[model samples]
Target: MDKNTIEILFSERKKVGLNLFEIMKEQGYTKISFSNRVKISRPTLNHLFEGEISSITTFEKYLDRIRDVLQVQEQEFLIGRRTAIGELQVAFSCNEPKGYHPGEREKEMFEILEDLINLCDFYY
Candidate 1:
């Protein structure tokens, strides 16, 4: 989309880390443990979370597996829902920007983030 929408999207994407951290704690999983259990290498998981987009193709495989494990469809979890996590009542997922076509790098990263958000919702 336009520059303002892109900026907003990027801003929202960063907040998923807290959601993820909460989810991991709720599920009793460390990064290493989660990676191993999910059959995704630690570095790949790191890359996905850190927005490192060099391995986009490889990321899709891991994303699919993550989605399967989370039992969430790719397009089904981005809506704003109220999920209680301790005292935090954050939106269950980020608001996706409409009519936006992300670049190769961002496309991969967004997909990963979206699936992970869904995974977080599933876990919590």
Candidate 2:
């Protein structure tokens, strides 16, 4: 492939990685849980999502397993429809009511935030 074509291919692969990560989250899968489900190490899952994978075979294995678990069509996964967020830095400051106890929403928020931060760290 020409230089431009190679760049486009890499860009699409990065999109696929991001989309797969989102699909996992939407389906209520954590890195550990999803890695276990896919029979991949947590680090491997992390690399795959970060688009830092070096081996095509390894990438295909993860993609195949994820595609099966997500029940998404191959085309949809490979050519992900969701636009990849270029770069995002989100900050949130919240205080609960004085007498209020945290609930499921708060717990979920914390978990999601942790995951998002971990994901962001991969790009740096």
Candidate 3:
């Protein structure tokens, strides 16, 4: 692939990352938890957001499986009240790094959110 084409692919991959973020947020998934769910490391997910593939071998092992995992996980997550909660504006606004792991408390918040979602799903 030419340099331009490679850059385009990287750009497209970033878009995918953003789309994945939206899906995750709707389902109350922080980056750390999503990485766990996807069975990929947090750094791998960050590299994906940065649109730079660090290891071809790693990609070969896991990249193709992401979609399949997402399908199954999405179904599980969608059992709760799912909707466009809001947008963070990170993609356009943040000038620094794009992906960051949630802190311990933040992760706890996500866990609480997940419990609430489960309750919502169970009740309705």
Candidate 4:
């Protein structure tokens, strides 16, 4: 997930909101019917379509339901940036050059931090 990919995902989500009403019209799905199908309240669906609330969980649930109904593959949802700052902090704290050789706990922490760093690089 580079910056360009993240931007594209955000753009798609915005487009989805705009197109949702059109899709509902094309599918002959009333507001109530779409709400029931997505297991969300009518007001919540309206807010989502209006872009009033940005709830990731709600959006994901709605999208999953819509994907199933439309026979489309589930789209990847982007939540936030991956900085790995916490992992970097932990990794720096794990440095015990004067203390001891790599023990089990140290090794585990190092491995976890390394993986986090790798993922951050891959996704950032």
Candidate 5:
């Protein structure tokens, strides 16, 4: 894609990151807890969430991690939250970051999210 296309996509991704923030808040997920659930460093998670990540690979990697953590489909996390805008965006914001590992229950949640994504793709 051209520079303009890439920029637009990146901007959209940032919006998705913002939406993910709302989801995390609703689910009672703090940066420290989320980083632990995703098994990523706090700084990297913060960079990803804030859209300050310069590397596309890093951005996508953390996005995938977040999708896993939230037990949401990738497309749902990125673009489908428009269906419930008001409920999803209720007074949500965060900046703090800290780290740890994804435990078995968290891994199960990720697997469920992945399965839902695949099921949606298969049916739709």
Candidate 6:
């Protein structure tokens, strides 16, 4: 992805904050409740919802918890067309990279997100 595409993806991700917050609200998750459910500290959850760009690992775990609690499909948590390859490249370039771990839970969650993205690609 080029610089312009990266810039556009970052802009789109910022725009997604409101929609993601709405989804949490729709699921009836108070900040405290969401923190407890997701096993993250309240302050951390606050940072995430307040548009702080957290580690991909942290975000992935949160997304997993949100999907599990809401009983929603993986696509429901995705940012859709806003997910440009540039944004993915940025995420992939995180300074503190996490190697793939095929623990059962991790594998399952990865597969779920992968499948959702693949399905979404059909419409792209």
**Candidate models: Cα lDDT each:** 0.54, 0.71, 0.55, 0.59, 0.63, 0.55
Candidate 4's clash total is 0
Among all windows of 10 consecutive residues in model 6, the one with the lowest summed lDDT is 85-94
What's the ranking of the predictions by TM-score, best on top? 2, 5, 4, 6, 3, 1
Model 1: worst 10 consecutive residues (lDDT sum): 73-82
lDDT of 5: 0.63
Better candidate by TM-score, 2 or 4: 2
> Whole-model lDDT, candidate 3?
0.55
Selected candidate, larger TM-score, 1 vs 2: 2
TM-score of 1: 0.41
Give the per-residue lDDT digits (tens) of candidate 3, residues 1-124: 3455334434466464555555656567777777888888877777765556755445434544565665643223223332565442221121335687667887787677778776643332
**Which runs in model 5 stand beyond 4 Å of their true positions?**
1-11, 79-124
lDDT for 20 in candidate 1 is 40
Task: Write model 6 residue lDDT over 1-124, tens digit each, in one string.
Answer: 3455434433444444444555666667766666677787766665565557545555555655666776765434335333333233211222334785457886677677777776543222
Candidate No. with top TM-score: 2
The candidate, 2 or 3, that scores higher on lDDT is 2
Better of 5 and 6 by lDDT: 5
lDDT of 1: 0.54
Clashes per model (N, Cα, C within 3 A): 0, 0, 0, 0, 0, 0
How far residue 46's Cα lies from its native spot in candidate 5, in Å, is 1.7
Give the residue spans of candidate 4 off by over 4 A: 1-12, 73-124
Candidate 2 residues lying further than 4 Å off, grouped into runs, are: 1-11, 78-124
Can you give the lDDT of residue 13 in candidate 1?
Answer: 38
